[model samples]
Target: MSVLQPEVNITAGLQYQGSQEKALVGVLCTGTSCSFLYINSVLLFTLRSKPVFCETSRYILLYNLLFADTAHMVTNVLLFLLAALKIIIAYIPCCVLVLLSGFTDIISPLTLAVMSVERYVAVCHPLRHSAIFTTRSTGTAIALVWAYNFIYILVQVFMLLYVLTKIYIDLHLYDFCSKEAIFSAPIFTKFQQTYHVTVFFAASVTIMVSYIGVAIVAKSASTDRASARKALQTLLLHLIQLSLILTSTFFTTIIAAYATVGRLTLIRVYNVCFVCLNILPRCLSALIYGIKDQNIRPVFMKYLFCQGRSSVILNKK
Candidate 1:
């Protein structure tokens, strides 16, 4: 019956593939990642080395935000850039690494939101602020925010793998968070039919509400012109943060739409904005921090000029 032995080995021929250009791109991206690494490293180094803030709550908050940014930059930005460069490694599934990176990325924004709320309370609700957002409470709140974020993203990763394997059973592809493969997965399809879009919309709504809640709570408690003015500035800072995240969110959603809708017109625009979004925060934070943080301004200027002059000399060397 098996005389001629009709046999095919698909697995034998299927090879994991990428190109030299991809490796080069990954290297270039790795280099870019290193550049930020140096800058952020210096920033954090300075943060730790300096006695920049003494007995100041605002300084503490700035330092906290810096930590969030640093975490996001190190974890998310690095993984993403690596993934873009396609550096698959042993002992780690690319998907898991990528998911963890995404999870930490979410933590950055969530932490920022918490920081904004804390600041709003300190400025706007100065009376109950200590009781609510005391050091312990603030620490707890940050812990919970991070815990929830990781768990939530883990669920997404789980759903992407399991739900799709059960449903689509066809497109057994792994790029779940990708715009192209999102709805194509069977589990994602079921998720879409069930609560996917609803939950996404809900999250967006919550971020909006969080902003408004902070604004109202701050404004309602303002008793004088100066207090009201302080409330507004704090609110504006939060709004700027919100705007930064919102604009990036806009780019992500728009790119997703283009992927889903096949809108070629927007591909370039979305990609451009996405790159800007990735780099803008680091630069913008420096600018905002320089303005809001008096201690950092002079130090930053000295470093900027000193570093510039050194580079000029090095080029001659």
Candidate 2:
């Protein structure tokens, strides 16, 4: 999983100075994950509760993005907890978790790329936007994104199994389950690096082109200037979000570069990077669309605050 593939020896940081420190770190990580999960769940519910959100192409895409992020976050936190507690599982189960983590990790940026193009169309080709991105078409795009990642993961699985069958190795892991530990073959490592670089490059180009297109439309007098401006802002956010998501693919490589530093310093740096690059990015979708979007804000707040059925009925009336 891209989330678990921090290029450094992850077990090094898992070894805390004391039990108290370990417990504190686990609590902090778990608490943060739980909070984000709650917000994402509520926002997902909000997206589903209304017909407007249901029929809107962008909202459907947003739901897909949030779902992928939530799944990735859950698997990531599970792996972290397992490492922290020194729990060792069988080889097959670890492979399942690792592959699942990788799938969810890769899907977000692809979904963002599609969302960017959707926005570009909305701003630059307003007349065709509705026809171009109906709910069915939006769903098909999402399915294609998922299918692409699924095929990639399926290839990795076949390669891993082939390697295992040819080699003499223990069925149980000697260390914490991670991509590096499980898929340790030189070929697997090289393939993953190449794949991540390719995907990141492609997503980057898609988003940049979309941003430039929207910016051009915003400057044109014939365009809906207000809508174009809003899209430009949204695309800018997508770029930031994309950078954060893709940065995680290199978390291990970045940390490994500094591996020669003192143990205490490295631990601190690893913890900070893990939280910033891995955990926090998964929650930004909720913050960006759940809170920032005007259309979703009222309904989101009503559910978030536990407004009663009476309030909803009154508002609808």
Candidate 3:
């Protein structure tokens, strides 16, 4: 959602200079997104093709996380493309895009929190981990995450409708469509800020508590030291991932702070922040779990390099 606003502004400045820079930046952004998309797609296939991955509760949650991240990347790239192209969309379509983007944005951190708790349970309650995180319960948890976001989107929709009914505006947007542009009402802004703060706070607390619990269990003599250490490392990775995702939500505020520094400086900073905060966070899961996880790394590498048959043979052995 922050993509459109900064992109539109940046694109406008590029237009003043020439079309080449705009096109170059567009290609760069799109190509980067496509590369990550391909990597995520392959990782998804790897997760699905293996029976072991499909059957495990942790892997199931990982698939959910990757799917959400991929969807988020796609939505963001689409929004960026729209802004870069200077395409003006009608209000309703724009709303749908924004809502989808917001939904995807919220899901990742929540999923990370769930994954953290799963790791905690595995470490602290090893005997009950299997019983507690059964396939059915895992599915239910994912469903609840989606359902919660759906309800949040519905609330935004109602707020939008209420605002529309109260005021009259052109259906066609003059500026590039964005959540801020469409839902510019003070009430909507306040509500979004409050909702984001609450959700993030809850997720942060969940992840922190889970990490603490896992760390405590890791030190206990009764626990399997190796397993406890692994779980603790996983939880730390989750915290890092959560931190990246959380930083992305502050994109607008960061941009705002840099506004008075001149357009050129702003553009340079924006591009840096966009890649680091927005693009990188979406793809970090693949790098983190895809490469760092020993079980996933081999299969991921095989599929990544298009050696699927060979990977199957190895797995069979």
Candidate 4:
């Protein structure tokens, strides 16, 4: 029988900071997941009650976004829990979760871009909005997004598996499997870096163009000021969410690419961004888009009260 020995090179200060940051990030991620799921659940229940809500194209897109974000946050929470508890999930399952998280990361941006386009069309072509973005068409677009993300991620996973055999059955080292690990992986090729850059840039351009088109159309739509205003609010939230996540991703990539980790300052900075900024977007999204939505708020309130009453009864018993 044999045991694989390990080495620990990180200093005590850095280790403390890293653990603290991970714990904070895990707490934030849990909050984001709970809030997002609660609001989406209530909103979904409300949508089910009203046939009109189910029939709207924008609502359909929103539903897809909610689902994608929930999955993304759940994977994040799982990763954080595993790290926090020092639990060694089998290598295969851990890798699968990591891939799922990456897939949703791509899906979030794609969904945001599609949402921006939907708003652009609605604002720019009010008369044709229904004909252009029907319920069926919106559903098909969402399906295509999922299909593309699945195929792309699956291919990348296969490529990585083919190139890096060491990672196949190894234990999940927190320092190695954490956010910083991606940059150091031997199999994280130039092609993968290019893919991320391309996705970010393309999604950014799409969002910008859509926002500009919507603004231009809004300028002339004096009668439809309300719809235009709502669209702008939604777009603003999406942009904020996109900026937060992209900024964290970019900073981590830059640190990994150019900076040396021997410097404690650089490592700490990378850890901070990785833990804090990385998970903030979903939390903000739940607040800005889900909680603040006029239609969803009432349903959420009802759900909250019902839960409160149920808890009170349980406590009394």
Candidates in order have lDDT scores of 0.54, 0.86, 0.85, 0.69
Deviation from native of the Cα of residue 17 in model 3, angstroms: 5.6
lDDT of 2 by residue, 128-222 (tens): 99999998999999999999999999999899889989997788888778766778788987888898889888988999999998887788788
Q: Return the candidate ranking by TM-score, descending.
A: 2, 3, 4, 1
- Model 4 RMSD in Å is 6.8
Candidate 3 whole-model C-alpha lDDT, 0 to 1? 0.85
Off by over 4 Å in 3: 1-18, 258-269, 309-317
- How much is 145 displaced in model 4, in angstroms? 0.6
Better of 1 and 3 by TM-score: 3
**Model 4: lDDT of residue 185:** 62
Candidate 2 collision pairs: 6-252, 7-252
TM-score of 4: 0.76
The most accurate candidate by lDDT is 2
Model 2 ranges off by over 4 Å: 1-17, 255-267, 308-317
Estimate, for each residue in 1-317, the C-alpha lDDT of model 1 and write its tens digit.
Answer: 36433433333333222244445545655566556556555555445546645224445555556665666556545545544644544323445554554554455455555655666566556688768765566667667867876676767768776755666444334432333334345454454334434433444454455556555664553455465465456556655665565455454555656666543335344335534665556445545665555577766665645674687789999
Report clash pairs, candidate 1: 163-187
lDDT of 4 by residue, 1-317 (tens): 13322223346656888778767755765675566567656655555666766888877777777677767767776776665566765555666787888788777778888989989888878789899899889989999999988887888777766656755534555443443344246456565667777877887888888877777777883638788878887887788778776775575556666476565556456445545665556556545654677876665566655774687789999
Model 3 residue 122 CA deviation in Å: 0.8
Q: What value does the lDDT take at residue 224 in candidate 1? A: 52
Please tell me which model should have the higher TM-score, number 2 or number 4.
2
Residue 302 C-alpha lDDT in model 3: 83
Where is the poorest 10-residue window by lDDT in model 1? 9-18
